[model samples]
Target: MGFPSLYGGLTCLDFANTVDGRALPEPEEHLHDYADLVRWAAYADLLDTETAHHLALLAKARPQAAAASYTAALRLREATFRLCAAPPAANDLALIQQGYAEAMSTATLTPAGTHYTWTLAGDHLDRAWWPAAVSAVELLTTDRLARVKVCASSGGCDGLFLDISKNGSRRWCDMGTCGVEAKISRQTARRRAARRTTP
Candidate 1:
């Protein structure tokens, strides 16, 4: 299947949300293999199409290395999710720290419109998650971290997202799915209660 819709607002949060219903008994995993990681990286705009295709080919040639990189990426994704959605552990912080350090070691500050941004040098296998590591660190250190929220959907969606709403009242990850499902559930319950009372 294709990757889930990007509703996390930030790349790091979006990365964390690759697994749906994280708190549920059986979570849905989107990234199945190295190709999935490459596809997701491209979809997330972490890598251009050309770079993504190169990585996919490289992964095919070096299956072991690609599997290792995919494992590390999943570790980073889980660490990021815990850090953002709950009180993080020391190991989570350490993993994120290592990821951020690795990313920065290869990053160079490049001029943007009015400021500079760190750009990764080459299209390494691990490059897929480098920007997400940097983003996670930047987000954790900022006040906007307070805006981070877990989806409030009762259907057990544990997706993480940045709630940039003005009033901070944002609840569901996506209004179309979780929000609509919740509304229908509540309505059905109300109707059931009304029928019980009438009879």
Candidate 2:
């Protein structure tokens, strides 16, 4: 589930609009980058999370939906980015919380309670963005503790994965990139050793 797809940056906004035919606002152009994903993730309200979760369900049920879920799945990119970024940004919670205030409500970002939470406008219910938004929150707060693995090449030049190992040490989303590079590097070292021995 960690490969590039045609709909790379479509986003939660795109997923909800595309599936339900209800357009809100488009995510910023650079949303594909990991940082934007982080903002999107924390920005998700309950409505949107549930929507995304159901979409994930749809993708699981209807294989063809995989094409679209690529963009859909990038929301998960938000959770992943949060996991990595939260540590560094932990001290900056006040500013982080300030930015999260939604237009309809000014829910304070506790930012230090070991979890994140927010309340969005109830009007978006029919929009039903809850599923996607909620799922993203769950991942950030409680769900993130679970183990996951993401693979990449020596320079992170390939696909990624969602490995859920118990010990949490799983790496390389796919062997094609990180796995192959390691193998090739080892082989090259071995050949170089053999040449020196023969001389």
Name the lDDT value of residue 14 in candidate 2: 26
Per residue, candidate 2 scores C-alpha lDDT tens digits across 150-178 of: 23345533222334556756555445545
| Candidate number achieving the greatest TM-score relative to the actual structure | 1
Report the CA-based lDDT of candidate 1 relative to the real structure.
0.89
Clashing pairs in 1: none
Taking the candidates one at a time, how many backbone clashes does each contain? 0, 23
The residue-by-residue lDDT of candidate 1 on 12-47, one tens digit each, is 999999998887899999999888988898888889
- Which lDDT value does model 2 have at 150? 29
Model 1 TM-score (2 dp): 0.93
TM-score of each: 0.93, 0.38
